[model samples]
Target chain A: VDAGALDAARSRDASLTKPPGSLGQLEDLAIWYAGWRGERPKLEAPQILIFAGNHGVTAQGVSAFPPEVTAQMVANFNAGGAAINQLARCFGARIDVHPITLDRPTGDFTEGPAMTEAELLEALSLGWAAVDPAADLVIAGEMGIGNTTSAAALAAAMFGGNPRDWVGRGTGVDDEGLARKAAAVAAGLARHRGELLDPLEALRRLGGRELAAMAGAIAAARSHRIPVILDGFICTAAAAVLERIAPGALDHAIAGHQSEEPGHARLLGALGKRPVLTLGLRLGEGSGAAVALGVLKAAIACHSGMATFAEAGVADGPG
Target chain B: VDAGALDAARSRDASLTKPPGSLGQLEDLAIWYAGWRGERPKLEAPQILIFAGNHGVTAQGVSAFPPEVTAQMVANFNAGGAAINQLARCFGARIDVHPITLDRPTGDFTEGPAMTEAELLEALSLGWAAVDPAADLVIAGEMGIGNTTSAAALAAAMFGGNPRDWVGRGTGVDDEGLARKAAAVAAGLARHRGELLDPLEALRRLGGRELAAMAGAIAAARSHRIPVILDGFICTAAAAVLERIAPGALDHAIAGHQSEEPGHARLLGALGKRPVLTLGLRLGEGSGAAVALGVLKAAIACHSGMATFAEAGVADGPG
Candidate 1:
């Protein structure tokens, strides 16, 4: 359950062909889990869980667009105008979005946490029910407005580090706005110190219901032995909270990508995991998760299709 | 076609959507020929020609291995360990890989120019005859060792450009190797100047039979009104020579990708076209053209699936 044990398990596999370590990011991901669970790796069937909520912090004028765009974008996702839709078709993956607590029309994000226990429970229930027992992997992503602030608070409460280390200029914020956002995250945690003692309590104190639900979904995926692919900063923070309570929850976790957010690298460093893609992206809403799935697809094909040089009657590198 | 005229035909009413300018690369590719052909815009069943040949220039030690790698790689393509296999599967498009010469093991690139005149005639004959009447577009890609040198020779002789400017490092070559390659291309051209006079003859003199067949294939695709998608420097240069002989040859041209090759940009410029994907890549064997097909699939979906606002009951972007 400890980080040392996790690393030991990841290094357990040295029997794979081609080379001792040639698959790059994929080799680490597969090897990490193979050691933990003692099973040869495969990513044949993957599940994507999208957690949706409305942020209460939009009143700060931090976002270039309105919070209503979150719900509208979710509809666009379901209607299939989005880039992820095409990617899903290419990768042959199923997607389901869980709308928790907040919906449309402008609302105040700084008014403490608007998420209730019921909303959080409902979203978690949907995500849990969606995973088929026959599924091979699980991926978790988040969609919410001013959601970065909530994710920051969640990370602060999960890891005892400073809130400033977790808070970032999400979705392209200017320098002044980012500094103010960091200060806001610290304030939210300071105000909610009493309520956020446990992981669930931390979710109730600083995050939307969807973030709490995502925490539950990740925990469930970990227990079920399904590798959980984390999208970006928000999802990584959610995993941090899940890992705080469960300790070994990240055994099934794969850091899908490192976003352009300054906070993301700090969080990933704490997790001791490196991302596969480094495309300088900070956009959330599962877009990072969407593209990273392509790597999973390639890995799957390599695992399943590539003939060992011995089997193919080819020289091993060069004789 | 003038640049303004090309831009104008792309914006004509009854255009493919969003005034035909919203899809970026896809829109530019489809419109490049709209002005040349004086056609409002129609993309019929496309042809994707994959020409395969082994490079004789591999003897220079610029590559990690010897000339035999060229033949081994062609066999790998047929077997499918490469990236193009997956990209081709994504589109389910027609593909043809012509092996015009078997001189890789012998290391004689200028050896009677792979495909004799009769062979070139037959290869083109068989390539276009395979095109289905339902086809709407065409793409051409080549695989050959020392093919970049051949492409440069064809380009220099036809466009009368400096060979150094037209020579480029194929695959991943160092600066020292690049200089040596430039010299080899120049020497090969001087050794076979007479065959370099006629585009077809120049191809017969210094080019691989696969490159020559690719040129003829593009010419046939133009007559068939099938938009020919050029994979990289080799295919693009072959297309350039064809365009020089017949100015209207570009009527069906579609620049698939701008490769990392030193001369690909110059070739695209002379053809008066731009590529779709500009990722710094020069690996041959049809991978770029195959991946570029996904753009067409996306563009087709956008043109066909975009709701008119009347259909979706949502407001449209201000026209």
Candidate 2:
């Protein structure tokens, strides 16, 4: 989408009976939707897809925990131990976690996409088919150990940018862990022979199973005209690949928050996106986006419900 | 109220199901209430009060806008022009705006309470009379122009804090404006003699009418054993005056956020209260507290709702 559609959305936003630009990025996000859908954005209900998988890069001793933690954390998320779970409840958004082929070590760098090509498509089809299809908005979040390496490698291969520019500390890595992770990412990109084709194949080579599923979900979100929120670094990385396969795919993507990871901002900037808040957040697992989602939804509500000064008979400061 | 009680609240917090100390000041705020009510704190329909007034000290040219903007903004607050009004809807919190007193140059600052003594008592009585007996929490927020100075002076005279320590640049004033405001505050304190024998007497001297009403609401919130949230400089200033009249009143007070004001930290420290969030917010009119209220409620939910590793049957660390 060019600036024209965005402009159309803004005009719709301006007529929402609130102060001009007072609703901030929320009005902008909704306006973007208005142009895409050819109607004013209405925040009826939002859905979130949380993709869970183990990374193929942790074999390099990148993370403090093992791949088994991934399965356990999945249970925790479903049971509401994680921040994202609480956020979903708080914002009244429904979240469904989708598992993308979990397999044991090829070291912790488990080869992703355990399903065969045809089977992978079938699995993705089933998952998307399960969604009730009436959701007004969508967000994709990923949870897997050592996933940032997978994200960076996919980001580098997909964006045609320096692999080094795409690497950063994932969770709690110091300078040393970051350096090691970057080197591993470089090797993964080289291993793929720079061949970033079908997303599942990319997952099998340089990414993780969760990434492939998330990419499909992002594409689905775009096709559905629902604003898909990018959660933390890895979600954006997959978003980058999906955006390339289907140009203008990112038009539906909203960068939720800036990550503490060095490369996350670069990824966001490369995609021409801006984050809603910067709280020095380093925790991933959709925490950043989950918090940001509340803001987005609140902004939408502000745009939709607030009475214009004219309607309220209050004077606005002169332009 | 005492070290022992505060310690008990802190100890109860560490035992909650979520990550240790993860709920932030919400954990502390809850604990503070445990001391107040001698039980765990749950935010069951918390109520917030916002009072509106203008300052006698404003004639010194300390603010970026005219004092009349105070009343204008109060009307805006009631009609939902500022962020706080939207936040009130977001959190399902109730708010009251009292147009109490102003610095209109013609009103006699020395003759009477910001409101009549009877009016001050009636507002306090009204606050006392309004709370739901079954409510689990309460919060007080004040919206007064140039009221930060009065709060500081009130703090200095009654709370036994230094004048410089209690004063702060409010609503984004320049250095020169802040200096003049500080001087006027000192003069006001000298003129009034800080007589706080009655809450109304305090109002007549140094308190904005809205500030005094806020102080009454704070007293009511404490007496009810419902947590009262102090937003930035103005609310905290009013809280200090209320506490001076009722020394045990700090029992349920919770500083909502660490504001950008120079004296906010000092005021919070004097109360032995730590703010739930440090967002550098200095804008008054209950916006800071209102924004923090959602997160605080989330924190309560986290503490009360999350399952432990043992209950969830998830591995805590490396197995």
What TM-score against the true fold does each predicted structure earn?
A: 0.65, 0.71
Worst 10-residue stretch by lDDT in candidate 2 chain B?
A: B104-113
CAPRI classification of candidate 2: incorrect
Residues A22-93 of candidate 1: C-alpha lDDT, one tens digit per residue: 344444554554443444445556677777777776666555446765665567667775444544554566
TM value for model 2:
0.71
Per-model i-RMS? 6.6, 5.2
Off by over 4 Å in 2: A1-42, A76-83, A103-133, A152-204, A240-252, A258-285, A315-319, B1-41, B54-86, B101-133, B143-207, B240-284
| lDDT computed for candidate 2 | 0.64
Mind giving the per-residue lDDT tens digits that candidate 2 earns over B191-260? 6663665545766566666666677777766666667677887778777766666665776767767777
Highest lDDT against the true fold, candidate: 2
How much of the real interface does each model capture, measured as fnat? 0.02, 0.13
Best by DockQ: 2
